[model samples]
Target chain A: MNKRKVYIFLGFSFAYLAGMFSSDIKSYFIKEVYSTEYGNLVFKCDQAMREHFIAKQVVAAKPNAEHASSLMQAEIALIDCQDYDLARKKLLSFGLNEYDLIELSLRAIEEKSEDIRKVVEIHEIRYD
Target chain B: MKFDTIKPFLCALAVWFVFAYTYEAAYAGLRDNTLIDAGKHFIYSTSLTPIDPNIKKASLGSKLFEDVRLSFNGKMSCALCHIDKFGSSDGLRNSIGIGGEGEGSERLDSDGLVVPRNSLPLWGRGESDFQTFFWDGKVEKEGGKVRSQFGDYAPSNDPLTVAIHLPFVEIREMVNDDYEVKSSLKTESVKSAEKIYDRLLERVKENQEYVSAFDELYFLKLDEIEFIHIADAIKVFIQSKFRLQKTRFEKYVKQESVLSPDEVAGGLIFFGKGKCVSCHSGRHFTDFKYHSIPFVQAGFGKNGFGVDYGRFNVTHDPDDLYKFRTPPLTNVEKTAPYGHSGSALTMEEAVIYHFDPLRLISTENMTPLERSEFYKKLLASSEDSELIPYLDDDEVDTLILFLKTLSYEESSE
Candidate 1:
């Protein structure tokens, strides 16, 4: 095999691999940032709506009116996720009405409320 | 020199050349085909998104607007009330819902009932500035950003406070409820209203046509069938199709509208001395803010008496009393009798109210107040006439011509 040919084959392989991995890589980065934002908002909202952010399993075990409110706050914090529709369902099965769902989501976006970076990280870990 | 060496080299070269040519040709076709496929996929995928270029959503929006099921009764579509011919009011003083028929005047508080207020025109209400709906600025509220003020108006009877109107509010007690039907008083009894709402969703879901449309564009989760989405979709439809008709005034400003000199002069009076510009600002001709002008409740009173507390009823604030939103003058020529109560029958009649509003300011007023405060400063002493300007009859005719230019009919297509 010629030296130039070896380089050409290598280049083509590299290009193909890059193209295949690009969207996933970009999505990962976006998810990370979004997760950071989501985390911060969840904390603020849990505090604002006076609910605590907890894992889905934990929430499911204690699905009561208070837990529902907490779930709503977390769901709002996670709304910017790519799988927000799914996240919303999981939250609602734990039980949240339409108005509560939307209101909480909007509240999470309020500026200067609290640190959302950690909540966003949690969101990334859960959804990403 | 050797026969073996020469023949072998030639054979090897020929094979190599052939393989290269075949590979190159195959790659060329693959590259072209891949490019085409990618472009097609991009176009198709984008069509499913909200900002799609092909505008499939807009087409769907048009179809939904034509769907009659949106009304409480299957008979009343948005088009029935806000028709093009009738100035968007069904040509009646008040609109009839599920209940019996009545003029706008008759819909006022009678038998301990009222239709709330006259139906607002849909044209240009989709403008971002016009978020709040109804007479009281109740639909989309404006609570300040302060944490304490958040949902400040939450407890109010505004439609936004609760996602759905109470069963009684939705049904039109158009006439005095002589039958004494308890179910009629509540929205819960409106004969399968929820089923109707569900059917609307089912129409979108079950219909093979809509399913394909949704699949092509984007799939909506069944659980997302809240009233807001329904309202948003309808809002989109109205925003997309029923755009306000552009007028000669637009062209005149751009030097494109053909206007006679007299009419042009009259146009200046409208914005300048006539003081129509203060409230009727922006492209669609309204600031979408509330104001109280001294105008009479021509028909019956919704809030009782001539004092129609506009935004006040919604806000329960003293400032908002009699302060209705300034109606956009988009199709003003057609959408009369003007005022919240539809009191003024003609533009001439309406304009005259602006000239001296004290007379019609309130039912108890000794003087007719100017219906439009925008013109009070413009009412020069030189204008001797109580109603229109003291300008020569020719200018008045010109003003009328200019006003005529504001007229626009919706596109038939």
Candidate 2:
């Protein structure tokens, strides 16, 4: 090939490679950032849920003024830190096993958390 | 020129002609005067009255509405939920009540008690003709008799006054469901409400500014002051502040202004094909009747267990199952996360749920129990769902644009 033609061919090759690799690099960076953020959020939510469960149990066992007050405080604190799924689960437990109330609360909680769930799903990464 | 040379030019001319024709047709559709006439007819059919507020009473009520001392927790007020930024709504799917601090997402992220229902906007709430109150119409007037949780001994004959008594006694809304509050209130009964009201009256009496305002407005002595008077003043303020104002749509109907073509198309859909007017008719854009629209349930529902029986809870009638009062649409654009549970995040999603609920929800994500519950709701909604015709994305967009026309020219409060 002539010198000018060879130069043009090389330029096109470089451009193609740059475009392909840049997209892959961007995707990798986004995946890393999203996964890290999501992981931290999940860990915090799990910890909150555990605390909430323990607090609820303590209130149920004691049923005293101090315990009730503590439970109330813990509920607010835990709710702030808990994820949508954990919140839904805790709210469902409030119904005990009343099928009618359970059915209604489940529907309501699902609808309420739909937006948050969608965001979480987007950020969720499956290594498998 | 040769035939070959002229062929390309002819093709270009034909393309241009088609484009121009389509543009003209679209423009003609936008400017169709018949839509204007139809819109006028729909609006004129409803008897709309202009409001005349008692400025002095409303001013006093305004002060009372903003007073945090009214709540048992001393942290909440009427103005907390009914904020100006979210068009008098707290802007969350479920309202953060009593213990909730700050506003909007900040409150959502805070240690607030989630109220398990959307914070309804306050526009046109306590107007003369607006009698029904709450998502369930728990407080209402029929044939001059005001019926509420109070039963026979309703605190006031005025439905708004009766309605105003709820938040103070409500467990999560204004009163913290703590040991002290629970023991003092006993249960959520009329007697309990009266006790809370008495306490609130005493608190208001302590405030010299409020005491003077009440005296000036109602000519009542500090000892003579009652919760009814407080409710009455707040009612007056709500009536004055959130009463319906002339919207762009109203102006268009009156020939004072014009709507763009998209808005006009949306109006037609709302009134005609969409069948939104069936329930959402009248001056306040609500018939003030209960209807089942089968919106996706959100939060912990009214009855608990992720379900809300809506009107059934109030009436205890099988036929009234899953029915809720048709919410008024004045300043609706500002109230995000629409529906009883605040399921729909955007206006488009809200509209879509009316006709195509399944489109917005993922059945795959639902548990068997959730699926069964949804199936029951779907069955209940079938009749009303059939009323709304299918609208394309563009049509839904235009419909939202038309809804925007319903917004007030400026914030009234």
Candidate 3:
């Protein structure tokens, strides 16, 4: 009813809308304009989600899926066989570049030792 | 007085139009993006999208699923272990497939060959994203690459198709553990698997019913047919029959249904204070990753003396010692006798084991050998178990109520 109150209401509405859109604008700008190839792959994977089934069917150590595990197995095998060339071949065959094996989680035994459940909890705590 | 009354009517009309315009605009905006965005999230969270089952393929698979010819012994069927009435699992701590008779616990009376591991339920096994199979996770997908016992000689690219190749030839599963069966089928080596596959193929081809079904599905001659064809059909059947159903929780999430206050409270604790969402994430309530929660070992155990190395036996890596997959929680209430060995008798017992495995295990019950083995398991899993917080009586009850919300009746005929 009064001009002052109406002005105050308008200002609060503007602030509320701004606060909401600020997150959207930042995400849009980073993902669409800047992050490019990296941000392009947000959800195009099952990744390690299906990496936990046991098979007594047959034993094949093909470099498939779960790059970390495959590469780790290959690395351990490489240490024994000392066959870098074969390891390199297996890497390419499994659709992994040799450089991908260099990831610290794959290299450092204990670095990736944090339990998966704990990691998820830590993520929520840090971000949520 | 007439002017005042007319003015009030005009003001009311203006207010009505303004409210109508604003409501329409807001709804339009929601429809264009917000609604779709929310819907996408709901689908992702529940993954309850029903997949259509191919009638002919599934029928063929259903027949083969109950076929004794799939086994070398000509006695056991896949149904012996994976009975549909038992939530696609035999309600036994250990399955008695090869020399076993009767159903459920009745099989325990037979001098049947006992399988080492508990029969895993076939709930969402053939879902497009369900790439893991077995208690040990021997067949699994990593970075889009599927790995199994087949090594470099994997039969199919899809893990489910490859995974289906196991049960028929596995000792005490479908294949009887005998010198004759072993020598005839070469059941140990992968080639023996192929040998048995050819025999099963011939049996199917000889049948007019199966031959016609295969011909209808693939437009193939008997000569052109392969075991992978059989595997794929069975996979399609599993995808159709055990397909994901929309749970009450999914409906509640979509704002299409209501939940009791207890379920809501349970859900809050599940994702919030309980930390269940850490491993039991997504629509399946599993991340499909492995963990060592220190459940008591039961049955003969994978390694004997009530010991199973679990994932460590699969890879032989010290890091993977005592780990098992975080099982999906669909119809978890029905698929009882939990753990890889069916050690926990109830869901409450299973949940309690995660935080306090020793509480359930009495030192008096275990043998001297079992005691040492359990200590080793406890030592290995103690650190991993500590990562999760303890759930008290009320919290565990609410969690079980929330779990009940995940149970649903399949509409499949």
Q: Count the backbone clashes (under 3 Å) in each candidate.
A: 31, 14, 22
- lDDT for residue B64 in candidate 3, whole number 0-100: 87
Model 1 RMSD to the real structure?
Answer: 27.4
DockQ of 1: 0.01
Interface RMSD of each: 23.6, 22.8, 15.7
Instruction: Give the Å error, residue A42, model 3.
Output: 41
Over the stretch B216-325, how does candidate 2's per-residue lDDT look in tens digits? Answer: 87899988999999998998999888877889988888779888867876776676456576578678888788877767778888888778888899999988788889
DockQ of each: 0.01, 0.01, 0.01
Candidates 1 and 2 compared by lDDT, better number: 2
Order by DockQ, highest first: 3, 2, 1
Over A1-128, each residue of candidate 3 has an lDDT whose tens digit, in order, gives 89999999999999999997875565445333322222111111111111211111112433443333223222221211222333434344544443443331132322333676745553455633
Instruction: Please rank every candidate by lDDT, starting with the best.
Output: 2, 3, 1
Residue A89's lDDT within candidate 2 is 46
DockQ for candidate 3: 0.01
Model 2 residue B172 lDDT score: 90
Per-prediction RMSD in angstroms? 27.4, 19.5, 18.2
State the displacement of the C-alpha of residue A123, model 2, in Å, after optimal TM-score superposition: 51
Question: Tens digit of lDDT per residue, candidate 3, span B168-282?
Answer: 7777777777787756765457898888788888888888988888889989888999999988889888897887777777676666776665676566546534546656766
Which residue runs does candidate 2 get wrong by more than 4 Å?
Answer: A1-128, B1-32, B411-413
